[model samples]
Target: MSDFIEQLSPLHTVEREEITKAFREVFALSAGKRVLFWMLEQAAIYQDAFAGEATNSTNYTLGRQSAGRRLIEMLDAVDPRFYPALLIAIADLKTIDLAAAESLAKQQEGEEYDVEA
Candidate 1:
């Protein structure tokens, strides 16, 4: 095997500490505000997926399917070609951004403001 191929191994395991440091270093080299905004977007997607129309449609449903089939279902909402990886992963987030979600709902309704003043 070539030198490059000799060192390459699929069994390589990255330590948690090293992964954390690498993640932080990557973000530090770029803009923090953009990442923050990206986080908000992920939160909105999460809210819509878990609490909005998406959730309602799939609620109280039980079925069994292979992991590949489930992946295709998630891909329906998010295109893997565009978003291969999230800036701030939200699929496993415990909470949603209510403010961001509310704003998204309003934008979809074509109403500027619904507050009665």
Candidate 2:
């Protein structure tokens, strides 16, 4: 991962350390929970953008593009171990059905809990 880190724009030592620390924290989260959080965050952006009748198509499109960029940034920052879960979450996002995505996440969370028990 050093190669991956080196490819990023240069950062001050403290800034680099902080980023590494943050990544460690994110990496510590259960994979399923991380995927669920990502789904909910994307859903929130869609809900906010489309909440009002006054919202224009342009605004909605911009919101979606912004959310997609953020998702890409998150995928880059996360550990490789989370890739499978992330891919699954991305697939659910493509369905454009927030309720179904949420249900899937909940089901995964339950399965994770059962495995732990």
Q: What tens-digit string does per-residue lDDT give for candidate 2 at 5-116?
A: 6776656656867865776565556564455456646645434455456668658656675876665566456555455565565675566577878899999999988985
- Position 69, candidate 2: lDDT: 61
Q: Which predicted model would earn the best lDDT?
A: 2
lDDT of each: 0.42, 0.62
lDDT of 1 by residue, 1-117 (tens): 257545755544334335445544543443432453354444343232333566544442212123323533343333453133333333323135566777789797866466558
How far is 62's C-alpha from truth in model 2 (Å)?
2.6
Off by over 4 Å in 1: 1-14, 43-117
The ten-residue window of minimal lDDT in model 1 covers: 60-69
Q: Give each model a TM-score.
A: 0.25, 0.37
- How big is the positional error of residue 43 in model 2, measured in Å on the Cα after superposition? 5.4
lDDT of 2 at 107: 99
Q: Which 10 consecutive residues of model 2 have the lowest summed lDDT? A: 43-52
